[model samples]
Structure formats: C-alpha cells, structure tokens
Target: MLVSKSAIAAVLALSCLVLVKPQVADAQAQRARGASAAAISYEEKKRQTSDIAVTIVTSGITCTCARFAEDIRDIVNDLRPDGLRVLPVLGVGGLQTLEDVLFLKGIDMGVVDEDNLRLLKKRDPALFANIEQRVHYITRLYNNEFHVVARKEFKTFEDLKGKKVSFNLKNSQTEVTADAIFGMLKIDVERLNYDNNEAMKKLREGEIAAMIVVSGAPQSALSRFRKEDGVHFLALDERSLPNHDLGAVFDNYLRARLTHEQYPALIPEGTSVPTVANRALLVAYNWPESSPRYQRLAKFVESFFDRIYQFHDGSRHPKWKEINLAADVPGWNRFKPAADWLARHKGALQSRDGRTLADLRPAFDQFVANYTASTGKKALSPRETEKLFIDFTKFLESQVTSQSTR
Candidate 1:
C-alpha cells in the first residue's frame, strides 16, 4: 500500500511512544519509593518527638510555675530515645491561663491560680459552664499568700478602706484576687494598678495608702523592704476588720500565717502575721482517653510524680517543699492518669520512699520540740505541723546528701 510521508512519520512516533512507556514507569516508581521512605522517616521522628511531647502553659517566664515547668522539661525530655517531651509556654496569668488551656490549640495543660477557677466561672458562667468537666487539677503546686503592705499608721486591712491602694498592675494575679477580696468585703478602696516595684515606691512616698501583692512568701519586692522602713504587713483579724464577713473570707481563702523566717526583713522573730492564701495549681485539660494528648499527659504524670522528691531539696525553690504529691486539691477532680498513679502508689502502705506519714511523726515532733526550745516559738498547729514536717524532711535529706557528697 502507498502511504503519504506524514502518515509514515505518525506511525513511527506511535511506535517510539510505546517503546518509552516502561522507562517512564520505572522512573516514576523509583521516585515514589524515595517519597515513601522519606515519609516513613518523618513519621518515625514525629512519633518519637512530637507525639510524646505535651505543652504546658505557664503564667510567665518569671512565674514560679514556669520555673517548675522548666524543672519538669529538664528531667522528662530524654533526647537519646526521644522520651516524654514537655514544652513550656508563657501565658497570661489568672483567668486567662484557664481560657488558653480550654480554647488554644497545642496547649495540653496550664498552671493557674485555684481561685481563678471560681473567678472565671463567676465572670462568665455560660462561657465556661462545664469547666469543671473540661479542666482537671494535676496538683496544687504552692500557696500564693495575700500580702497587704501598708503604712504603720494603717495597722489593719480595714484601715486602707476608702484609701488609694495599688493592686500590683491591671488584671495581674494580685489585682484579680485583691479586687475580688475587696469587692466581696464591700470595702471601697480606690484601686490603682502599678507593678510592685513602682507601687512600693508610691507606698513609701505616701502616694498610696497600701499596696497588695498576691504571691508566694519571701517575694523579692516585699523581702527588700525592712520593718524599719515604716511599712508593715497588715494583719487581718476581727478587731481589725470589725464589720466585714470573716466567714466568707475564711471560706474562700485558706487560713495562713507568715513568719519572720519567710520574710526576715519585715516580720519579727516569734511573730506570725495573720493572713490568707490561695493555691497555685497545675491543671490539665480533660482530653479524652482515646486521644494522643491524654497519652502524652499520662506519660508526663508518671515522670512528674515518680520523681517528685527531686523538687523537695532545699536547693530547689523553697515552695517546692510545699507540694504533697498525694494531697488532693480542693474543689477539683485530679486528672485520671495522675489519680490512677497515686491510687497505686498511695495504696495500703502509703509509701513515699518507704516512709509513711506515721513513720515521720516522731521525727517531726522532736524537730518541733528543738525548734520551739531554741526560738521560743509556740508549737505549730496540725496543719502547720504538716507543712513544717515537709521542711524538716527536706532538711534531713539535704544533710544526708551533703554528708554523702563530702
């Protein structure tokens, strides 16, 4: 058959296309295999690091909780095997931390003031309706004492009524609690917002009658001031606050006393100024059991509680000694994994390093006896005894460690 030149060229091209098909397929397969290997490696790395990681939001870098979180991350994240990773994030304190944990993605937990649990609910009932179900306490970390520094003439908290008072900056944890306390008590103080440093200057200059700071005791701002400075920590007693509802106050706050040991510059030896304190809580969102977040939190919980004693040394923050791992936080259910771990360890023996509460009583009593004899201070109450015993145990541990190291 006679064929045109164009038809012959088309037939030749079709034959060439068929011959190259297998080569194209082989290259495509090679590229796909390479992609699959890379994907597998990426997934493996993700499983080791990101999958095991849990992010915990803290109030701020300087916040006690952030320091504690750093302590956790340092111990928990095992680089060799890519073990449990704790990522600490800075958050706005008080109520905001709670909201961040609830709503922000990548946040597994938060450190918050316990009072904020109620305050947030009180502020927006509908918004955080089931917050109880949504958030759970891993533990109560430390006590944030309500500090009221006033002029010597203003001897009591009530004396500051109708006076200008600094609540330690706007929407700060100090201001939040101070506002709540004053608002609840019906005290009509003119509220001012200034950082403690500036407020302290203002107080000394008589620019403000009093300044309130809610923080762990021995706070630097208060510690720097001397009793000779004409400023004092106001006592909150019935005689001082005659008409206010002390019942409501006590109900909301934990009864506490600040001693000279905590703030040597302000409080005199053998003196304990009456005060109230709220708890700093490490809280976790109630992630479902089926979720990867829950698994990561569970691993973090195990590492935290098991090595809990690491925080109790005198070398660590003095506040670290305050945390009783098995101690249940008030008004909050513990995270399930934490509760389970405690349930198993806090079993019949109640073994904390093979020493139960009963085992420590005699040692505590003797220390108290020696302390009282030397300092001429009165014996502490049951609650105070428990807190004292924690300090005593840490002291003994440090002494042992020191002797061993030597």
Candidate 2:
C-alpha cells in the first residue's frame, strides 16, 4: 500500500501495453483474412475463364448420329476435363449439320456423313469451292449402311427399273447416295420424296416399288417390319457397278452385308444381303490457330482422344465400336490441332525405343516411298498415309501402355 509515484507510473504503463497488444493482433488477423479471400477469388475467376463449353450439331432426334452425340456429351461431362462441356444440338441431318458448323454463329462442331461433302460440292459447286479446306474432320464415326427395301416382286436393283422409289426427304443422305448409285448404274427410277414413315406406308400400299433408308445397321424404323410384310432388302451388286475411279462417289462407299443376325425377324437365317456403306465424320470448322476458339477446341480434342476407351466399353452406343479415330476421310483434311496432337504422340504410342511421334516420321515416310518404288503403283494419299501411321501408332500404344499398366 506504500507506493511511490514512479511505481504507480510503471503499473499504468504495463496495463496500457497489455490492452493495446490484443488490438494490434486482431487488426493483423483481419488483414490476413482479407488477403486470403482476394487470392481465392482470383483463382476462381481464372478457372472459370479457362473452362470450355462447345456445342456440337447432330442429326434429328431419331438418328443414331444424335444418340452418338448425346453419348459423347455425357462422357465429356463425366470426365469433366478442365470444365469441358459438350452441347449436342439436333439438326435436320448431315447437310444441315454441315451448314450449322460452317455458317451458324457460336457453333463449334458437327456430326456429318462423309458423303455430304460430295453432295454439297455437287449441289453448289461455287458455294462449296475449297470447302474441304474450310471444314476438317476430328474423327470418323460409324458407317451408315445403304438399305434398299423393295416389294417382293423386285428382286434386284435392275428389276425395279422405271419403278417409283422414295429416297426419304430431298438432300438426305439416302437421297444423295441413292441418286449417285442409280446414276452410276443407269437405273432410272422415278424418284419420289417422302419421310421414312410415309415411305413405309407407300411401299405397303404399292404406291412406291421401293424405298431407301441409309442409316446405321438395325435401323429402328426397319426393325418394326414383320417378315410377312413382303418386303426384302435388294442386293447392291458391287460387281455390276463399273470400276470406281479413285475419289469418286463409289470410292467412299464400302461393301457391307446385311445379315439375319442383325435382323432376325426380317432376314432369313444364314442369308446375307450385300449393300454399300458411308461413314459419319465428326467435323469442325477450321478456326485459326492463334484464336481462342482454336485453343479451346484443341483442349477438347486432347480430352476426347485421351479418354476414347470409355466410349467403346459397351456402356455407350453400340455404334461406338465402329469408330476409328485415325480413319482417313478422303478429300477432307484433319483439324490442325488434332492432327498435330496425334502426330506428336505417334512415337510414344508405337515405339518401345523412347522416341517421340516426330522421331518416327522419317521412317514412315521412307516406308511409303519404298512401297511406291517397289510396286510401281500410285502411292498412298497424304490422308491415307496419316491414317496408316496412326493405326500403327495405336497398335504400338496398346501393347506398350497395357504392359506398363500391368
């Protein structure tokens, strides 16, 4: 209780120091929280900006093209690679899909039949001049089998000469392919235009002798038909058709068979019907390499190719099994970014010698050169060569990647 003035001053100063220390600490903590919040906001903005959302135009609701598009959309969404989002739009068909990708604003890609390129060229040569250079394929999808269903009276394409036939709607894949096939064979049938259902009714009513449906095998529309309906698939004899000139309409069409296995109720057991098929292609407009759109698309390509196995695992559409990512689409070029990605990974995929894809380019080129020199025949086209190179690379990747994983 006996305190001096210096002791009293010392006690007051100590109290002041204790009170101010907590205030200063609280202020510092508040500033730290503010700085952390700002850093988090910046990161979120960067991530959103880096995300890619693209729309792919596909065929109408009933088409396998649309189903394939939806499957891709789901797979890409599931993978969620860097926020990649795929939007599949339903268009009229292949031609519309092409027009959407080419002319429509904000459209990134389309699912089109390879034959549509030829049809576009023939229909509007001026409009489609250098079209191949404008539109590029990402990958080749499944084949569309050409189905020529006829009345029992018409056994072969020749027997139905001068008879009325429906090629679905005008500018459709069936119409384009049927016209070209008929023109090539000199079989002049009175061409009629009708929807698939209407054409089916007409065929049953004897209004049309035959109808053509160009779609993937086991077409849903045709599956509804009963064997007692008296309709049969006409055999497209490749032998009857003249030798096709390279890069012609006949060139893209492959010889395919329709068997009872595919249509048990319609086709008899152990019987097969011969027909032609055209491939569907996933094509994109050639955006400039320097543009943001191109970069975004390139990201999508890498994600798609890297996870392609998911599409073929039987969970997706059955048509996915037919997809050959490296298949060649004659007369069309590949998207630069996609082609470059494939090329860069080619060596790693195929060679056990630790070489990059670029390292194997010279050997691939030499092989082509040697083959042409030895056989005295025309060499593979640039697209064909790229396809073979990719195929070989894929084979190598399977062996090497599988072993490494094990």
Best by TM-score: 1
TM-score of 2: 0.70
Which regions of candidate 2 fall more than 4 Å away from where they truly are? 1-51, 78-82, 238-252, 347-406
**Model 2 per-residue lDDT at 52:** 67
Worst 10 residues of 2 by lDDT: 1-10
For candidate 2, lDDT tens digit of each residue in 1-406? 1223343234333433443457788999989978865776766766654466777887656677878888888766532325677888877665777888889998899988887887788879999988898899999989888999999998788878889999878766677778787777777888898888898888988889999988888777887778888898988764534343323445657888888977787789999888888888999989988887888788789767755655765577677878766677788899987887777655353356555444555655675566557757566665455445545455455555566678
Among all windows of ten consecutive residues in candidate 1, which has the lowest summed lDDT? 1-10
**Can you tell me which runs of candidate 1 are displaced by over 4 Å?**
1-49, 352-406
Candidate 2: residue 235 Cα off by (Å): 0.5
Q: What is the C-alpha RMSD of each candidate to the true structure, in Å?
A: 22.1, 19.9
Candidate 1 lDDT, tens digit per residue, 89-207? 98766777888899999899988888887888888999878898999999888988888998888977767778999987666787788887887777889888887678889998889
Candidate 2's error at 285, in angstroms? Answer: 0.8
